[model samples]
Target chain A: MKKLNYGIIIILGIISFIPLLWVFITSFSPGNQVIKGGFPFWVSNPTLENYVKAWETAPFIQYYFNTFVIVFGVLIVQLITITLAAYAFARLNFKGKHVLFILFLLQLMIQPEILLFPNYQVISQLGLVNTKLAVMMPYWASAFGVFLMRQTFKQVPYDLDEASRIDGCKWYQTLWHVYIPSAKPTYIAFALVSVSHHWSNFMWPLIITDSVDSRPLTVGLALFAQSYETGAQWGMVAAGTVMVIMPLVIAFFIFQKQFVSSFMHSGIK
Target chain B: MAAKRKKFGSSSRHNLFAYGLLFPSFIFLTLFTFYPTLKSFQLSFYSGPMTRLQFSGMDQYKEVFSDEIFRKVILNNILFMIGTVPTSLFLAMYLAIWLNKKMAGSSLLRTSFFYPTIIPLIAVANIWLFIYTPQYGLLDNFLHLFGRGDTSWLGNPNTVMIAMIFMIIWKDTGFYMIFYLAGLQNLPRDVYEAAEIEGAKPFQMFRHITFPLLMPTTLFVMIVAITNSFKNVDHLYIMTKGGPDNASNLLLYHIYEAAFTNWDLGKAAVLTVVLIVIMLSITAFNYLYLDRKIHY
Candidate 1:
C-alpha cells in the first residue's frame, strides 16, 4: 500500500511537469513546425530564430519597462501605507479604531472585479487612462497588506515601543526606527507577494492601458498572441511567454524557501 | 498643574498623529474604493451612455432578473465554482499530503507543481489554447492514444465550460496545495503518533484526526478558491471570450463585455452591483458561518 501511494505521487509529479516541458520544447522547435507532434519531447533541429523573431515583432523592451514601473510604484506606495496603517491598528489607542479597521477589512471581502467599471470611471475622471499610473493607482493601499502587517506587528513585544517612547521618539520616528526594522521578514514576504501579483496582473492593466507605450507584458503577450489569426504560433508564443515569466521564475527559484514560507505564513492564517 | 496641562496637550497631539498616520489610506480608499462602490449602486438606477444618463429606478434590476443572458451567465458562474473549487481543493490536499512526507526531491516536485501558479494567466491561457486545439494539441493527441477521436475542447459549446474548468483546476490545484502543505507542516507530530498508538488506520486517522485539524485551512482555501473563481476572467476573455454561443460566459466576464464591448454602461453598472451584492453577501455568509469555527 505504501509503495502504491509513493508510485502515485511520483506519477503525479511527472504529470505536473509535462505542461512546462511541452512549453520548453515548443519554444525551441524550428520554424512553424510547432504542431508536427510525435510527443513534443524531441525537438529536431531546435533554433533560436523564434526567440529573435518574438523579440523583434513586439516592443517587449518597452513593455518590460512599463511593467517594472507599475510594479515598483505600487509596491513603494503600498509599503508605506500598509506599514503605517498596520502600525496604528496594532498599537494605537485612537477612537473608533476597531470600527475603522473593520471597515478597511471589508475591502478584502469585496471582489476587486466588481469595482472595475467604477474604478475605470474614476481613472477616466482623473485623466489617468492609458497611463501606467492608472494601473498603479487602485492598488496603492492594499487591505490585505495592512492586515498582514498588523498581524506581524502585533507579535512584536510592547516593550520595544515603550522604550522608544521613553527615549522621546515620536510615533513616526518609532515606527521607522523600530517597528519597520523589526518587521523585515513580513516586509520581504509582502514584497514578494506584491511583486509577483502585480507582475502577472492582467485585466486591470489591460483595461487601463491603450497602447504599447503603457502596456505590460501580460497585455502585450495577449495582444501579440491574438494578432496571430491562424492560432498561436506555438514557438513564438512559448518564447514570448517564457520571456514574460522568466524574471519571476528566477526570483522564485533563488528564494524558493522564502517564497514558500511566505506563502504559507500569509495563507494559513 | 503644569505637568497636567502638558499631558493633555501631548495626548491630543498624539491623537492627531494617529489620525494623521491613517489619513492617506482612508482618503485613497474613500476616493477609489468606497466611492466607486457607492457610485456603482447609484449608477445601477440609470440607463444610458457616458453623457446621456436617465433615471430608470429598479428597471435595471427587473431587466437583470428577466434577461436570459444574465440568467445563463449566473448559472455558468455557479457551475464553474462548483466544478473547479472542490476538485482543486481535494487534489491539492491529496498531493500536499503526499509531498509532505519525507521524500526525495520533494522540493523539485513542489516547484514543478507551483510553476503554473507563477506563470501569468494570459500566458497560461495561450498555452492551454494550443493544448485544446483539435489536432495537434497535447490533450487530443493523448486521448487519441486511448482510441478516441479528436475533440474540440474549447470550440464545442457542450464542452467549453468543462474545458475551461479543467484548465482552471490544473492551474490552481498546485497553488492550493501550498496552503495545505503549510497546514500539514503546522500540525503537531505527537498527535499523529498518538493516533497511531491508539490503533487508528490511515483512513481512520485521516477522518478522525487530520480532517478535523485541517478544517481551518480548508475553510480558508475554500473562501479564497471561490473568490478566485469569481475574479478570474482573463482566461475566458482571452481564450473563449465567453464564447461558443456564450456557453462559457461567467458573471465577471459578462460584466466586462457589457461595460466595454457593448457599451451598455448602465446595464453594466447594474450587473456590477448585482455581482458585488452577490459576492459580498456570500462572503458575509461564509464569515458568519465559518469565521468563528476557524480554530487558528
Candidate 2:
C-alpha cells in the first residue's frame, strides 16, 4: 500500500510536470524540431533563435518594465492599506469596527470582475485609462490581505503591545515594533499571494492598457501569440511564455519552502 | 508613560488613531469595492445614458435574462464548475494523503504538482493553445503515437471546454492539495490509531474518520473552487476567446465581451447584477450552513 501510494504520487507528479517540461524544451528547440516531436523530451538541435525571434517580435523590455511598475505599485500601496486596516481591526476598539471588518469580508465574495464596467468608468473618468496607473489603481487595496493580517495580528500576544507601549512607543510604534514583527510570517504570506496574483493578472491589465507602453507581460504575451501574425509560431510562443513565467518560476525555485509554506499558512487561515 | 500605555486600549484618542489608520483603506475600498458594487446594482436598472442613468424599472435585468449570449455564458459557467470543482477537490485530497507520509523525494513530488499554480494561467493557456492546436500540436502529436490524428481541441465547440477543464484541473489541483494536506496534518492521529486497532480498512477509516474531519477544509476549498470557476477567465481569452459560437464562453468572459468588445455597459451592468446575486447566495450558503459546522 505504501509503495502504491508512492507510485500514485510519482505518476501525478509526472503528469503535472510533463507539460512544463515540454514547454521548457520546446522554447529551446528549433521550430522545425518542435513540429516533428518524435524525439522524446530532449531536442537533437536546440537553438536560441526562438527566444530572439520572440523578443524582437514583442516589446518585451517595455512589457517587463510596465509589469514591474504595476505589480510593485499595487503591492506597496496594498501593504500600507492592509497593515493599517488590519491593525485597526485587530488592536483598536472602536465604534462599528466589527461592522467595518464585516464589510471587508463582504468584499471577498464580490469578485473584481463583477465591477469591471464601473471600475473602467471610474478609471476613465479619472483620465487614467491606457496607463499602468490605471492597471494598478483598482487593485491598490486588497481585502484578503486585510483579513489575513488581522488574523495574524490577533494571534500576537498582547504583552508585546504593552511592552512596546510602556517603552514610550506611540500606538503606531507598537504596531510597527510589536505587531509587525510578530506578524512577519503573515506579511510574507500575504506578499507572496499578492505578488503572484498581480504578476499573473491578465484581465484587468488587458482591459485597461491599450498600447505596448502600459501593457504588462501577460497581456503582451497573449497579443504576441494571438496577433495572427505569429499565430502558427509555436516555438516563439513557447519562448515568450517562458520569458513571461520565468521570474515567478525561478522565484518559486529559490524560495520553494517559503512559497509552499506561505500557501499552506494562508490556506489554513 | 506606563499609565498612558495602559490607557491605550479604549481611550477616545486611540479610537481616533484607529480610524486614522483605517482611513486609507476605507477610502480605496469605498472607491473600488463598495462603491462599484453598489454602482453596478444601481446601473443595472438604469439606462438611456452613461452620464445620467434613468431608472428604467427592470428593463435592463429583463433584457439581460433574455440575452442568448448571457444564457450561453451561464450554461458554460455551470458546465465549467461541474467539470472542475468536485474533480479537483477529490484529486487534491487524494494527492495530499498519498504525499503526506515522510517518503523519499516526497517534497520534490509536491513541488512538481504545485509548479503549475505559480505560473500565470494566461501563459499556461498560451502553451496549451499550441498543445491543442489542430494537427501539429503536442496532444495530437502524442495521440498519433496511438493511431489517433488531427483533433482541433480548442477550435471545436465540442472539445474546447473539456480541453479547458483539463488544463484548469491540472493548474489548480496542486494548490488545493496543499490546503488538504494542512487539514490532514492538523487532524488528531489518535483517532486513526484507534481505527486501525479496530481492524478498520483504509477506505473505511477514510470514509468515517478522515472525510468527516476534513469537512471544514472541503467547505473552504469548495468556496474557493466555486469562486475560481467564475473568477478565472484569463485562459478563455488566450485559448478560445469564448469562440466557436460562444460554446466555451463563461459569465465573466461574456461580461468582458459585452462591456469591452460590444461597449454595452448597460448590458454589462445587468450581467454584473446577476453575478453579484449569485455571489451573495454563495456567501449566504457559506455563513448559514457551512460556517456553523466548521470545527475551526
Candidate 3:
C-alpha cells in the first residue's frame, strides 16, 4: 500500500511538472532548434538569445515597472482601507452596520473583474483610463481583505482595548498599538494573498490599459506571444513567459511555507 | 442628568469615529462595486450606445436571452463548471489524504501539486498553448509513440472543451488540495483509531468518518471553485478566444466580447446583469450552507 501511494504521487507529480518543465526547456533551447522541433526535450546547444530577443521585442522593462507600481500601489492602499474598515466592523458600533456590512459583502460577490464594462465607463469618466491608477483604483477597497482583517481583529481580547483606552490612547492609537501589532500574522497573510492576486490579475488591466506604459507582464506577454503566432517563435514566447512568471515563482519557492499557509488561512477565514 | 448626557455624547462620538473609519472603503466600494452594479441594472434597460440612450424596459435582457451565442456561452460555462470543479476537488482530497500521512518526499509532492496555483493563468495558457499546438506539440509528440495521428485539440470544437477542462484541472487541483490538507489536519484522530480497532477498511473509514467531518471544507472549496469557474477566463483570451464557432466560449468572455468587441453597451449591460444574478445566487447558496454548517 505504501509503495502504491508513492507510485501514485510520483506519477501525478510528473504530470503536473511536465508543462512547466517543457516550457522551461523550450525557453532555453535555441530559436532554430525550437523551429526544427518534434518536442525538443533536451537542448544540445542552449542559449540566452530567446530572452534577449523577447526583451527587445517588447518593452518588458516598462511592463515590469508598471506591474510593480500597480501591485504594490494596490496593496498599500488596500492595507490602509481594509485596516480601517475592518477595525470598525470588528470593534465599533455604528448606524446601519448590518446593512453596510452586507453591502461590503456585495463586493466579494460582484468583483470588479466581472464589472469590466461598467468599471471602464467609470474609469473613462474619471479620465483615468490607460493609467496604472485605473488598474489600481477598483481594487483599493478589497472586501476579502476587510473580511479577513475583521476576523483577526475580533479575536483581540476586549481587555487590551480597555487597557489602551485607560492609558488615554485614542481609538486609532489603540488600534495601532494593540490590534495591528497582534494581528501581524493576519497582515502578512493578507499582503501575501493580495500581492500574488494583483500580480497575476489580467483581464481588467488588459481592458483598461492600451499602451506598454501601463500594461503589466501578463498583458504584455499575451500581446507579445500573439504577435509571434504566425512566425512560430515558440522559444521567444516561452522566454517571455518565463520572465513574466519567474519573480512570483521564485518568491513562492523561497516563501513556500508562508504562501501555503497564507492561502490556507484565507480558506479557513 | 450630567452623567447621562456625558455617556450619550461619548456614544455618539464613537458612532462618528466608526463612520469616519469606514468612509474610505465605502467611497471606493461605492465607485467600483455599488455604482457599477446599479449602472449595469439601469443600462440593461436602455438599448443604445453610451452617447444616446432610450429606455426600453427588459428588451435588452430578452434579446440577450434569445441570442444563440449567449445561450451557447451559458451552456459552455455550466459545462466548464461541471467539468473542472468536481474533478479537481476529488483529486485535491485524494492527494491531500496521502500527503497528510508521514512520508519522505512529501514536501516535494506538495510543491509539485501547488506550484501551478501561483503561476498566472495567462502564463499557464501560454504554456498549455504550446502543448496543445498541432504536429510539433508535446501531446501530439507523445501520441505519436502510440501510433496516433496529429490533432488540433483547441481548433476542433469537439475536443476544445475537454482540452480546456483538462488544463484547468491540472492548474487548479493542487490549490484545492491545500484547503483539504488543512481540513484533514483538523480531523479528529481518535475516531480513525476507533474505526481501525473495529477492523474498518481505509475506504470505509474515509466514507463514514473523514468524509462526514470534512463537509464544511468541501462546501467552502466548492464555492471557491465554482466562483473561479466564472471568474478565470484569461485562458480563453489566449487559447481559444471562444473560437471554433464559439464552442468554448464562457459567460465572462462573452460579456467581454459583447462590451468591447461588438461595442454593444446594451447587450453587455444585460450580460453583466445576468452574471451578477448568477454570482449573487451563488453567494446566497454559500451563506445558507455556511449557516447550516455552523449549527452542524
Candidate 4:
C-alpha cells in the first residue's frame, strides 16, 4: 500500500512537470526546428540565439523594471494600509465598525473585472493613465490583505497591548514594536501572496498602460507573441516566457519550504 | 490619579491616530473600488459610445438581454464555471488527500504541482497554444501515436471552450490543492484513528470523517473558484480573444473588448454592472448556503 501510494505520487509529479519540461526544452531548441513535435524532447542544435532575439525584440530590461516598481510599490503601500485597517477591524471599538467591516469585505465579492471600466475612468480622470501608477492604483488597498492581517492581529493577545500601554508605549509604537514584530509570519505570508499576484497580474496592466514604456513583462511577452504572427517563433516565445517566470520561480525555489508552509498556514487560517 | 487621567487622554488620542492612519486606505476603497461599482450601476442606464454618453434609461440593460453576444458570453461563463470549478475542486481534494499521507518527497511533489500556479497565465497560454496546434503540437502528436487524426483544439468553435477549461484546471488545481492540504492537516488525527480502529474502509473514512471536516475550506475554495472563473480574462485574451466565432468569449473578456477594443465604454460599463450583479449573487448564495455549513 505504501509503495502504491509512492507510485501514485511519482506519477502525479511527472504529470505536473510535463508542461514545464516542454517549455524548458523548447526554449533551447534551434530556432528553425523548435515547433516540430516528433522530436519534442530532443533539441538537435540548442542555441541561445532565441534568448538574444527575445531580449532584442523588446525592452525586456524596461519591462522588468516596470514590473518591479509596480510590485514593490503596491506591496509597500498595501502592507501599511492593510496593517492599519486590519488593526482597526480587529481591535478597535467604534460606531458602525461591524457594518463597515462587512462593507470592506464586500470588495472581495465584487470581481475586479467588473470595476475595470469605472476604474479606468477614475485613473484616466486623475491624469494617471498610461503611467505605472495607473497599473498600481486600483490594487493599493487589497481586501484580502486587510482580512488576512485582521485575522493575524486578532490572534495576538490583548495583554501585550495592555502591557505595552502600561509601560507608557504609545499605540503606534505598540503596533510597530509588538504587533508587527509578532505578526512577522503573517506579513511574510501576505508579502509572498501579494508579490506573486502583482508579478503575474496582466489584464488590468494590459488595459491601463498603453505603450511599451509602462508595459510590464507579461504584456511585453504578450505583444511579442502577437506581433510574431506569421508563425509564433516558438523558441523566442519560450525563452521570453522563461525570462518572465524566472524571478518568481527562483524565489520559490530558494524559499520553497517557507512558501509551502506559508500557504499551509494562510490556508488553514 | 493625574497619571491615570493622562493615560486615558493619550489612549483616546492614540485611537484617533489609528483611525487617521486608516483614513487613506478607506478613502481609496470608497473612491476606486466601491464608488466605481456604484458608478457602473449608474452607467448601465446609458447607451452609445463612451464619448457620446447619454442616459437612455435601461435601454442598455434591455440591449444586454437582447444581445446575442451578451447571451453567449454569459452562457460561456456558466459553462466555464461548470467545467473548471468541479474538476479543480475534486482534483485538489484528491491530491490533497494523497499528499497528506506520510510519503517520501511529498513536499517536492507539492512544489511541482504548485509551480504552474505562480507562472504568468499569458506565458502558460503561449506554451499551451503551441501544444494545441493542429499539426505539430504535442496533443496532436500524442493523438497520432494513438491512431487518431489531428484535432484542431483551439481553432474549432466546438473545442475552444473545453481547451480553455482544461488549461484553467491545469493551472489552478494545485493552488486549490494547497488550501485543501492545509485543511486536511488541520483535521484532528484522533478521529481518523478511531475510524481506522473500527476497520472503516478508506471510502467510508473519507466520506464520514474527512469531507464533513473540510466544509469550511470547501466553501472558501468554492467562493474563490467561482469568482475566479467569472473574472478570468487572461487566458481568453491570449489564446482565443473570443475567436473562432466567439466560442470562448467570457463575460469579462467581452467587457474588455467592449471597452478597450471597441471603445464603447458606456456599453462596457453596463456589462461591468451585469458582471458584478452576477458575481455578487453567487457570493450571496455562497454566504447564504455554505456559510452556515462551515464548522466555525
Candidate 5:
C-alpha cells in the first residue's frame, strides 16, 4: 500500500510540475532545440541566451517594477479597507450592520469579468485610463479579504476590547494595538494570498492598461508571446513566462510551510 | 456577554464611529461592485452608448437569448463546467486523501500538488500554448508514440474545448486540492479507526465514511469551481479566443469581445445580465441547500 501510494504521489507530482519544469528548461534550451521539441524534457546544452534576449526584447525590468507597484499597491489599499470594514462588522454594534455585511458578501458572487465594461467606463470616467491605479481600482475593495478578516477578528476575546477601553485606547488605537497584534497570523495569511492574487491577476490589468508603463507582468508576458511580437519563439516566450512568475514561485518556496498552512487556515475557516 | 453601557444618549456617536470605520470600504464596494452590478442589470434593457441611449425593454436580452453565438457561448460554458469541475474535484479529493496520510515525503507531495496554485493563469496558458502547438508540439510529440501525432488541438473545433478544459483542470485542481486537504485533515480519526476495526474495505470505508463527511467541502468546492468557470477566461484570450467558428467561446470572453472588440456595450450589458442571472441561480441553489448546513 505504501509503495503504491508513493508511486502515485511521484507520478502526480511530476504531472503537476511538468508545465513549470518544461517552461523552465525550454527557456534555457536553444531556440532550435525548442522548435524541434527536444528541450523541454532535457536541456543538454543549457544557455542563458533566451533570458538575455527576452530581457533585451522587452522592457521586463520596467514591467517588473510596474507589476510590483500594482501588486503591493492593491495589497496595501485592500488591507486598509478590508481591515476597517472587518473591524466594523466584527466588533461594532451598529444598526443595519447585517444588511451591510450581506451586501458586502454579495460582491463575492458577482464575477469581475461581468463587470468589465461598466468598470472600464468608471475607470476611464475617473481619468485613470493608461494608469496602474486603474488596474487596481476595482479590486481596492476585496470581499474575500473582508470576510477573512471579520472571521479573524470575531475570534478575538471581548476582554481585549474591554481592557483596551479601560486603558483609554481609542478605537483606532485598540485596533492597532490589541486587535492587530493578536491577529498577526490572519494578517500574514491575508497578505500572502492578496500578494499572490494581485501579482498573477491578468484580466482586469489586461483590459485597463494599454502600455508597458502600466502593464503588469502577466499582461506584459501575454502580449510578448500572444500579440505576435516574438512570433512563436518558444524559448524567449518561456523565459519571459519564468520572469513573470519567478517572484511568486520564490515566495512560495521560501514560505512553503506558511503558504500551505495559511491556505489550510483560510480554507478551514 | 453584554458590557456596561457608557452613555445611553451616545447612540448617535457610536453609530457615527461605526460608519466612519466602514466609510472607505462602503465607497469602494458601492462604486466597484454594487453600483456596477445594478447598472449592468439596468443597462441590459437599454440600447446604444452612454451618450445616446434608448429604452428598449427586453430587446437586448431577447437578442442575447436568440443570437447563435450567444447560444454557442452558453453551451460552451456548460460543457466547460461539466468537463472541468467533476474531474478536478475527484482528482483533488484523491490527492488530498493521499497527502493527509502521514507517509514519507508526503509534505513534498502536497507542495508539488499545489504547484499550480501559485502560478499565474496567463503564464500557464502560454506554456500550454507551446505544448499544444501543432505537429512539433509536446503533446503531438507524445501522441506520435501512439502513431497519431498530427492533431491540431487548439485549431480544430471539436478538440478545442476539451484542450481548454484540460489546461484549466491542470491549473485549477491544486487549489481545490488544498480545500479538500483541509477538509480531510479536519475529519475525526476515531470513526475511521472504528470502521477499520469493523473490517471495512478501503473503498467501502471511503464510500460509507469519508465521502459523507466530505459533502460540505464538496459543495463548497463545487461552488468555487462553478464561479471560476466564468472568471477564468484569460486562457481563452491566449489559447483559443473562442475561435474556430466560436466553438470554445465562453460567455465572459464573448462579452469581452462584444464590449471591447466589437464596441457594443448594450449587447455586453445584456450578456452580463445573463451571466449574473446564471451565477445568482447557482448561489440561490447553494443558499437553499449548502448555506444552512455550512454554518450549523
Candidate 6:
C-alpha cells in the first residue's frame, strides 16, 4: 500500500513537473532542434541565444519597471487604506458599521477586474488611460486586504489597545505602535498575496495600456508570443515565458514556507 | 447627569474618528467598484455611444440575450466551470490527504504540485499554448510514441474546450491542493484514530469522517473555484482567443471582445451586467452558506 501511494504521488508529481520542465528545456534548445522536436528531453546543443533574442525582441526591462511600479504602487496604497479601515472595523463602535462593511464586501464580490468596461470608462474620464496609475488606481482599496487585516487586528490584545490609549497616544499612533506591530504576520501574508496578484494581473492592463511604458511583463510577453503564432519561434517564446515567470518562481522557492503559509492564512481565516 | 452627557459627547467623537479612519477606503470603493457597477447597470438600459443621449430600455439586455455569440460564450463558461472545478477539487483533496502523512520526499512532492500556483496565469497560458501547438508541439511529440501525432488541439472546435479545460486543471489543481492541505492539517487526529479503532477502511474513513469534517473548507474552496471560473479567462486570450469558432469563449473574455476589440460598449454593458449578476449570486450564496457554517 505504501509503495502504491508513493507510486501515485510521484507519477502525479512528474505530470505536474512536465510543462515547466519542457518550457525550461525548450528555452535552451536551438530553433532547429525545437522544429525537429520529438519529446524534448535532451538539449544536445544548449544555448542562451533564445534568451538574448527574446530580451532584444521586447523591452522587457521596461516591462519589469512598469510591473514594479504598478505592483508596489498598489501595495503601498492598499496597506494604508486597509490598515485604517480594518482598525475602524475591528475596534471602533461606529454607526452604520455593518452597512458600511457590507459595502466594502461588495467590492470583494464585484472585483474591479470584472468591471473592466466601466472601469476603463472611469480611467478615461479621469484621463489616466495608458498610464501605470490606471493599472494601480482600481486596486488601491483592496477589500480582501481590509477583511483579512480586520481578522488579524481583532485578535490583538484589548489591554494593549487600552494601554496605548492610556499613554496618551492618538488613535493613529496607537494603531502604528500597537495594532500594526501585533498584526505583522497578517501584513506579510497580505503583502505577499497582493504583490503576487498585481504582478500576474493581465486582462485589465491589456485593455488599459497600449504603450510599452505601461505594459507589464505579462502583456509584453503576450504581445511578443502572439506575433510568433504563425512563425514557429518556440525557443524564443519559451525563453520569454521563462523570464516572465522566473522572478516570482524563484522568490517562491526561496520563501516557499512563507508563501505556502501566507496562502493558507489568506484562505483559512 | 453630567457623566451621562460626557459619555454621549465622547461617543460622537469616537464615531467621527472611526469615519475618518474609514474615509480613504470608502472613497476608492465608491469610485472603482460601486459607481462602475451602477454605471454598467445604467448603460445596459441605453443604446448609444457614451456621449449620445438615448434610452432604450431592455433593448441592450434583449439584444445580448438573443445574440448567438453571447449564448455560446455563456455556455462555454458553464462548460469550463463544470469541466475544471470538480475535477481539480477531487485531485487536490486526494493529493492533500496522501501528502499529509509523514513520508520522506513529501516536501519535494508538495513543492512540485504547489509551484504552479505562483506562476502568472498569462505565463501559464503561454507555456500550455506551446504544449497544445500542432504537429511539432510537446503533446503531439509525446503522443507520437502511441501512434497518435497529428492533432490541432486548439484549432478544432470539437477539442478546443477540452484542451483549455485540461490546461486550466493543470494550472489550478496545485492551487486548490494548498487549500486542501491547510484543511487536512486542521482535521482532528483523534477522530481518525477512533475510526481506525472501529476497523473502518481508509475509503470509509475518508467518505465519512474526513469529508464530513472538511465540509466548511470544501464549501469555501468551491466558492473560490466557481468565482475563478468566471474571473480567470487570461488563458483564453493566449490559447485560442476564444476561437475555433468561439468554441472556448468565456463570459469575461467575451465582454473584453465586445468592449475593447469590437468597441461595442452597449453590448459589453449588457454582458457586464450579466457577469455581475452571476458573480453577485455566487458570492451571495457563499456568504449565506458560510454564515450558516459559522454557527456550526
The per-model DockQ list reads: 0.69, 0.71, 0.83, 0.63, 0.72, 0.86
TM-score of chain B of each: 0.95, 0.94, 0.98, 0.92, 0.94, 0.96
Q: Which sections of candidate 3 miss by over 4 Å?
A: B293-295
Tens-digit per-residue lDDT, A83-145, candidate 2: 999988887888778788788887788856567778888888789999998898777778888
- What lDDT score goes with residue B23 in model 3? 92
lDDT (Cα, tens digit) per residue for candidate 1, span B1-296: 99999988988887787888888788778767788889999999988777888899999989888999999999999999999999999989988988888778877888888878877888889888878888788888889899999998888989999999988888898889999998898888999899899889999888988888988888889988998988888898679999888899988888888888887888888888887887787788777979876745
Q: Which residue runs does candidate 2 get wrong by more than 4 Å?
A: A228-232, B1-12
Could you report the Cα RMSD, in angstroms, for every candidate shown? 1.7, 2.8, 1.3, 2.6, 2.6, 1.3
- lDDT per residue for candidate 1 within A156-199, as digits (tens), equals 89999899999999877888888889899989989988898899
DockQ winner between candidates 2 and 3:
3
Q: What C-alpha lDDT do the candidate models reach, one value each?
A: 0.85, 0.86, 0.92, 0.84, 0.85, 0.90
| Candidates, ranked, DockQ | 6, 3, 5, 2, 1, 4
Candidate 4 per-residue lDDT over residues A72-112, each given as its tens digit: 99999999899889888888876567777788887888745
Candidate 6, CAPRI quality class derived from DockQ: high
**Higher TM-score: candidate 2 or 6?**
6
Q: State which candidate has the highest lDDT.
A: 3
Off by over 4 Å in 6: B1-4, B289-296
Residue-wise C-alpha lDDT for candidate 6, range A1-269, written one tens digit per residue: 86897899899999999989989998998888877755588898899999999999999999999999999999999999999999999988988999999999899899998999999999999999999999999999989999999999999999999998999998789988999998999999999999999999999999999999999999999999998874258899999999999999899999999999999889875
Number of the predicted model whose DockQ against the real structure is largest: 6
Residue runs of model 4 more than 4 Å from their true location after superposition: A1-9, A35-37, A230-232, B1-15, B49-52
Q: How far is candidate 2 from the true structure (C-alpha RMSD, Å)?
A: 2.8
Each candidate structure's TM-score, on Cα atoms with residue i matched to residue i, is 0.97, 0.95, 0.98, 0.95, 0.96, 0.98
Q: RMSD in angstroms, candidate 5?
A: 2.6
Tens digit per residue, CA lDDT, model 6, B68-166? 998899888999999999999988898899998888889998999998888999999989888888878888888888998699999999999998888
